[model samples]
Target: MTYSGDVTSGGAPAVRELDRLTITKVSVGPMDNNAYLLRCRDTGEQVLIDAANEAPRLVELVGDGGLAAVVTTHRHMDHWVALEEVVVKTGARPLVHADDADGLPIDAETLTDGDTVAVGGCSLEVIHLKGHTPGSIALLYRDPAGTPHLFTGDSLFPGGVGNTDQDPERFGQLIDDVEHKLFDRLPDETWFYPGHGKDSTLGAERPSVPQWRARGW
Candidate 1:
């Protein structure tokens, strides 16, 4: 089926097929957290974006391909509720930003800005985006045959940057990071998968950046 990026808790996942990789998105937890499984088309090597919630379902989602790693987007509790259990079952190495590594249940391999993570023959470039959490990150995969795809974690969504609890400093930091690190660097064709809810292209949300900053969300 076509990928719409629309999913509900306990519902079927939406799969996006790329030239070299396949992205499967699942919605989990009461918070409607989204977990993505990226599988290399050539090698079948897979990496999960977040454990989120529903350990059994996530394990089932992995199936026989086996997981290479689990990358936690940030240090928030909602994003890692099933992290430890998922890792225990899959034996996948847990990866996270260095600043948020100390907050996870198990020890995770720390990543920094510009670090490259391998997914079989494919690799993802890590983008460290601060404010949502000290180490919130986004993974970017530049598809050779097509456009770019990004896993933005909680740092970005369609409407605005991630929550900063109405703090001006935190909001400014997040918007700045998002604008320069993401918008300025990525092309408009970039399709982004957020931590929750629907997916959107950078071009679709580009016009509203100024409004989001003005509203101070």
Candidate 2:
């Protein structure tokens, strides 16, 4: 949600622990993009999503442990720059889509649509949301309470959508995927965690559909 706390004295963004997942908002490079750490509650397995540019901070947060996987939403430098350090420290498998899987600096498991990866008691459903990047993906997982959670990298934001300057067709496809695959199929109560900004429920952002369609689709 709101980034309430200030950055730590060490130039690292604040870290928030959510149940099993420990989300560290690493302030890296000039952009200060957000990086996430997802750890399993039961097995203590950790997964880092989008390290952005904060390699050192990401390493610090993921001290020696079961670093299960490194899942990147896309191949942007901001998202994967720190991935090399993460791979060395965690020894976790790197996950990404087949289209944009290259120069990862680490070995990765290329994933396709409908593929599932288990993190603790939950399973992450990989959904292709192409817009920000050709192989951009959103990871879906249901919490123990049965609440569906979507980790939409840079595809879908709270009140807005990701930038689509590169390819209009890909961007249009992303909008279509969200409309038909996500909003139209999933329940309105699904919780969304984007690549930046506050978290929101599907119902809260559903109204933005018309806006997306009018502008690009």
Candidate 3:
């Protein structure tokens, strides 16, 4: 089930193999939201993160392997614009955190922190990171080779944390979760894929945690 060469489709770029897993990254819609297709190479079963936009293109990407589920990192409209269409086309179940489930346009299965979603032979552990939205969640995949990959939705980005309202409490929660659940526990090589822009490693962003807190964004 090894896929070589360029797996890029439409304008989306592929990240190729991260150990045994295959990750394809697609940027869609006006907001340039990032949609990811994570495939379990051993079984070909896959899950999509943030159906963002462009149903036709997304359906094409799903292909014959089919989709096991579609996960919405948060309830943001931009992240789920094509969710309905994609689900209709593939019959994939929708999953989102219980806290933000009410905001989604369609009915979804509630995912709590620590829940594990199986994609073929691989498993993605869910981590609820609050404050980006009450239900903002991140998925952690520990490669067999020991490197870890994190799908952080809009919560943790390359340069800073997700945008929060002016309320000090909300901002504090987001930083705390990121520090404890992510930076403190994960290794430096953990690769973080965000909902937009570029990917970054924990080591690259770790040194600036103090600065991020002082700025209060």
Global lDDT scores for all candidate models = 0.95, 0.75, 0.90
lDDT, candidate 1, 1-217, per-residue tens: 7789999998999999999999999999799999999999999999999999999999999998899999999999899999999899999999999999988989999999999999998999999999998999999999999999999999999988999999899899999999998999999999999999999999999999999999999
Model 3's lDDT to the true fold?
Answer: 0.90
Candidate 2 contains a number of clashing pairs equal to 1
Q: What is the lDDT of residue 202 in candidate 2?
A: 90
**After aligning candidate 3 to the native by TM-score, how far in Å is the CA of 121 from where it should be?**
0.4
lDDT of 2 by residue, 75-187 (tens): 87777887887777667788889877874666688999899877765578899887778888898876655567788888888776788884678777878888887899788
User: What local lDDT does model 1 show for residue 30?
Assistant: 92
Candidate 1, poorest ten consecutive residues by summed lDDT: 1-10
| Best model per TM-score | 1
**Model 1, residue pairs in steric clash:** none
- Candidate that beats the other on lDDT, 1 or 3, i.e. the better one: 1
**Each model's TM-score?**
0.98, 0.85, 0.94
Colliding pairs, model 2: 52-78
Better of 1 and 2 by TM-score: 1
